[model samples]
Target chain A: MKKDEVPQDDANVLEGKLKTLKYATNEDGSYVQVQTVGWEPENLALSQAWEDIHERLEIIAQDIAAGKSSPILYFMEKCLMEPPMLAKHMGIGTWRVKRHFKAKGFAKLSQKRLEKYAYVFEVPVEHLTQFDPTRTS
Target chain B: MTNKFNHRQSAHCENGVVSNLLYHEGIDLSEPMIFGIGSGLFFSYIPFVKLNGNPGTSFRIYPGYIYKRATNRLGIKTKMRTFRNAEKAMDALDANLEKGIPTGVQTSVYYLPYLPSQYRFHFNAHNIVIYGKDGEEYLVSDPVMDDVTRIKRSDLMRARYAKGVLAPSGKMYYPINVAKDFDLKPAIIRGIQHTAKDMLTIPVPMFGIKGIYKLAKDVRKWPEKVGERKAGLHLGNLVRMQEEIGTGGGGFRFIYAAFLKEAAVIMDMPELNEIADGFTKVGDRWREFAIMASKIFKQRTNVQGDYQLAADIIVDCADQEKVLFTKLRNLKFPA
Candidate 1:
């Protein structure tokens, strides 16, 4: 907070349209009120990580479209889980989970199996099974 | 009935909301003051509770504790309610807004349109104030934002009903009444004492000072037990918990230090200033741990991170906090 000690009336004005914190300052470059404690470093890093997560999601969506990977991968990433974690949650083996990650294997999933995944992901069964990967929302 | 409420940006959500509401009530209090009086600080590491496949590690008390405790200390009688149905919750908020009462509501952070997409997650327990409505959009005063932002009813509803751990459940709260006086000395004393006991006296090893030590020990084993990639994820998550999200860094140690500094001035307890400085150093140590972990996360190092060394750093933090809280617990405040 030594930054706060710079005798000022306001924090510097933020530049970007993004809602991240910025300092407000006077025209003469005097100190003013702080918009927030700057999170530039941490948030910058988080943004990169989030981009990576979304990148995986986009690839999974492509796989689903190409009938390669199943929509299960999409739900898994949405729920912030990996195969091993979901396998543990579903009381199944990781190999089974990995198999289910394929479109052909997922299409043959039992109602009971699909229901278990829906339960763990906290999504409706229909939403899980009939989801449109292209739908951004 | 909508009043033009002053919107001030703050470091954290709940504390900002509390400060804004109090200011509207004609009581100007700093965010740290509200936090300290409300006893907003706490620690709990529940390995059984999982968030994104990692053990749930929280630096502060559950959401709404600060608003509840801080308001009560100020003799403010507030009404808070949660609903099973989203319609009723929206109806109640509309009613309060119609009555010119800016109400506080909890929502998930993911759906707030004003925030950067990267920062948005499924995490619930974000607090904001609804000050007005224009046709379909509600005027929102999200504390972390630089100005008042507008959100459509549908988006806001989705935010309120967001599912997952610690779901908001369409919860809203507002102060129904405010008293003329609140005796601060006792509240400050009580809050400090409560924090001390929780940090030092709690028998559970996964909470307070013990929790810090336990995390230090458990974290070292993550690489062995979960593999390098997943272990790396856990460490990164720990950093997020400490630095990103709602924490103002070092799990809010610096914020608490600022609180102590203000408390010292208000109560004429200059010694509290010394303790506050110590806490700042503690926060710095936390930052140090974070910097070290960041290197591991970025895979910048040639060899695997020295988990033992990192664990030692946290143990040192815990040790410093233990001694500091002990002194704070034993300190006699003037009656």
Candidate 2:
């Protein structure tokens, strides 16, 4: 791509706060580094991916509200994590992590266990326990 | 006990880290040179591996291979360590800084507070250099950033220990010995040859130029094999990996082209210059593919025929790369 041809498409996800570096061909056919705000195709791909994540999270949030699931699922989806991944982060068995996804199993958790989960999620234990579904996306 | 580290930005992280560290040691090598000599250019599409519920795609070699291979070919000795205990890892890093060593640390992008919120994800294997320390903060030289930045000790710790796939686990490395004088000709040849062989001769359909063809075939089947939304998500993931951050566009193809240009001058091979231009065209095709795939991903077009069109573009890319790498593999080098 030519230096002048580097895409400067407005990526609202970047919020106009940052510019990324790119390599473009100069007149001599040699490469020079150029800063780009964003490219249209890349921005579209990114938004679509994020949209998929949000859609999944919205479904999980509804489940939590209906008492079919726990807040753990909500936070897990928010963080782009699966049960196996969350289990690895929490240093627990995979089956145990799955159990925690349910409301009944989550209610029986001890304080120490809750603290461990909170630490991995980087949230306070109280926030996990008293999460408001409407406040989150 | 801080080392006199000079920070310079580059198009990619590992390449930037390798080039900056070598420059700090009084051996100046541009990021393109480091990337080329390191055999960093690669491609792989693993359908079995899932990321974000989509098949994984990689545009470069495995993490840390660039540093390992590039330095090895240059005959530089380096020390690397990874720790299971976070406290011990932090202590080891502090000790290295105490000895005036600017250490390369692998971290998770998600925990780096200096980055924009949108860029923060569960991505591990991001590399940065720590040159000095203040009371509770450490000076960071992230190759992707335009300027040097700082991170709190606590934040750095979290980044190092962030869990999930390819977790850093507090990995740190630094060059211990670099030869005062060395020749670049042989290393450049070895790097080029290594890349050609890998791209052309890899037997697996999921790797090398073959991987591109496989992905092209898969792209056509995606909407049929899976539903539209899932297939679109898969294509979106492919675009994310292709135009990955810090690659300077067209995956890593542009950097490889720059490397070839530099190598042509140093090795006095005019033929290599022509080859470099060909590869640049291939890179352009890759970008073209991204553009089409992104449209399909966003469902911007009403026609379902877009899938076959996108697949054709990918096939064109694969065919171009096949010709380039075959010519590259057959090229002769001066002893």
Candidate 3:
């Protein structure tokens, strides 16, 4: 069958045939899922996800409260991207990007890095530092 | 926050002194002066009043007179010199207030850029009070409304003052004064540090199962509820982190994802199985997008890489459920 022509019954049958599967989709039109025999355990795992995120986020929050610089800087440096490129990749706005660098006392470095990364990202310089990265995702 | 609280208390003490001095000595203070002591910021004349006969409407009176009057009434003597900065200004004011009196003076001073108005920024006033000194650093009581706060001169130097209020035309107000020989430095400093610690340590339990259930209720309706929760969590984290880090940066994404996830889950209503199926399909795609975005962010920002690693270990421990969280938002809540 063509990509969108698969019968609903056939799709359901195929999904049921897979003993341990929960199908999902991808941007490229591919299917993905999680399948496991122990439904209860899986459900519990899903429930605990928020706590996991909170725990990790708390450390960063603490570091922030202690007057430490944002860990994003270290992460970007490690990733080999200039600060602006990293900011762009993260979907932060230009104004906010500048403010972050300024607040961290690294405006000069941030500005320089933005120019360097603009070429590598192959997008407009403006696009590299657009308003919100998360929106696109 | 501690500094802010202590400053407020000290201000109250100063206000009492001013009130007592006025009642007992029959010293007539300008309305702005009284308001200054009341609100911890200077007030402008409201056209009906005149100062120095200039038909003066809107002017900030110098705070020195209030300090001098209070000290003189209390029979305290200390050297006074005008300083260029708020810190020096506070020290001179405090010292003069504490002079021969066995008890040191507690006073809070605030600077406002312009007269308060409906259109003006709500919190344009910045306050500081001197309760004592420690070693080389003067201990300050900050009118932050939290609790007693003491801060080092060094820390205060780094802290931002009300920019507009510090300007030439900004009104300066002094609301509190004290005449007690109590050294409150240690307490104030302890308070500030404690507040910082508390903010950092506060826990935020994500209601994941409830969030998911809400999402499963209706996708179209999910955004608002999820947005509200996400905004709350994000703001909480931001405030705490700003205290810890001294500044917040590039963390809005975490909030955004939480909001989106909540919306996605809500869209997957069980009643609309067909729509729910489509939503699940789209949800997977959204999850993949979130993961890709997160990876890109990690590659670019490198924020909390170690923490991310730890989270990865936990994800592994939980048998790596293929929920959108681990891959996308990097946060997981209890189901």
Candidate 4:
């Protein structure tokens, strides 16, 4: 039966039941269900536009989990230049970038934020900075 | 200068020849030599045995100021160690008036055996006395250097042979007069406790950030009023933020998301045509869940004395919505 043809109450019930069964499985078992949710037409069409933009972000996270992110070298290159240009290129606000650097103990030029910055550049959807939208550039 | 060396060398050397040779060199030769022994304090020393036998020995070394009195007398204190080669030992002993037994006390030069090959000979051997005119050089009775040689400050610094002198092998011994009071147990306990507390407090934000990101992804398609394009952008931004900031809220994801939500509400472009009503309900639910998680987090911090409970709240919320959000996004909404 098509998802839209199904009654709203029935869909809600199925969703709740599937959810219960879904979370019951362990981490490995949940992957199929996770993908299935994204594949459903009632959901996919509504979120497709944004999903494309987020694909890079998902890939970056997967890279981080897989240990491919290099936070050190990136920050090293960043340090040899002005903070503003680096922030702009990275699509984050300068203050936010600075805060991240501070928290990660990269206060010195030798320190790098390769992994963290990789994740940032990879995901382009969020507001990477603290710039007030109302403020004119 | 002559009197002090004569007193320390009298027990180890009896020959007048070595003593005469040192007097010719312009070295002061009298000051008691002091050497910093590394692991020497652990092996043949008294404190090391005490500390190993009773774990509380650390208290004396690091007593809290408030409990100084109670811990001060817990262990013996000793003067630092020094050495003299055979040449200096003979000369100083020969110049002394008091024969047989001297006025100053002579302590053993204790060292370790497993030291790097360069130091093996000095390991646990009685090689020298604390005498020499220059005060920095050791007149050695060394079996390794042979024929009562003189070793300079540079040689001693590079000598990795004496374990007791170089490393604290958990032992210490010295003249009775040089002993002091110390306790070792409480100090060790305090160190362990401080480290444990630090580990517990610093990782909560990372967990919260990841949890919220996952929550946003699950509810991305639920808000139809925000339109597909806008909702997608919001989710994309969230994913981006998670990658950049480490999805660990560092305790700030909620505030940031709230602002983004406001932007969505104000823009009102109506891109979510097919599933507008369903999307609104899901958006409301997502907001409610986030607030609930935040409340639980704050309460856990206040009552439980840790962020574990708060992190668990996030994990639980994520677990609950994982399937629903995925399905919502994948399914086609009726126009």
Top model number, DockQ: 2
* CAPRI accuracy category, model 1: incorrect
- For lDDT, the strongest prediction is 2
Taking the true A–B contacts (Cα pairs closer than 8 Å), what share appears in each candidate? 0.11, 0.61, 0.00, 0.01
Best-matching candidate per TM-score: 2
- Residue B73 miss distance in model 3 (angstroms): 22
Off by over 4 Å in 2: A15-18, B1-3, B300-302
DockQ for all models, in order? 0.17, 0.69, 0.01, 0.02
lDDT tens digits, residues B139-197, model 3?
44332222333455543432322222222222223323434552222222222222223
In order, what are the TM-scores of chain A for the candidates? 0.71, 0.90, 0.30, 0.23
Residues B56-88 of candidate 4: C-alpha lDDT, one tens digit per residue: 111011111111211222222223223334334
Q: Estimated TM-score per prediction? A: 0.82, 0.97, 0.24, 0.15
lDDT score, candidate 2, position B123: 87
Quote model 4's iRMS. Answer: 28.5
**Considering TM-score, where higher is better, how would the candidates rank from best to worst?**
2, 1, 3, 4
For residue B265, what is the lDDT in candidate 1? Answer: 79
Better of 2 and 4 by lDDT: 2
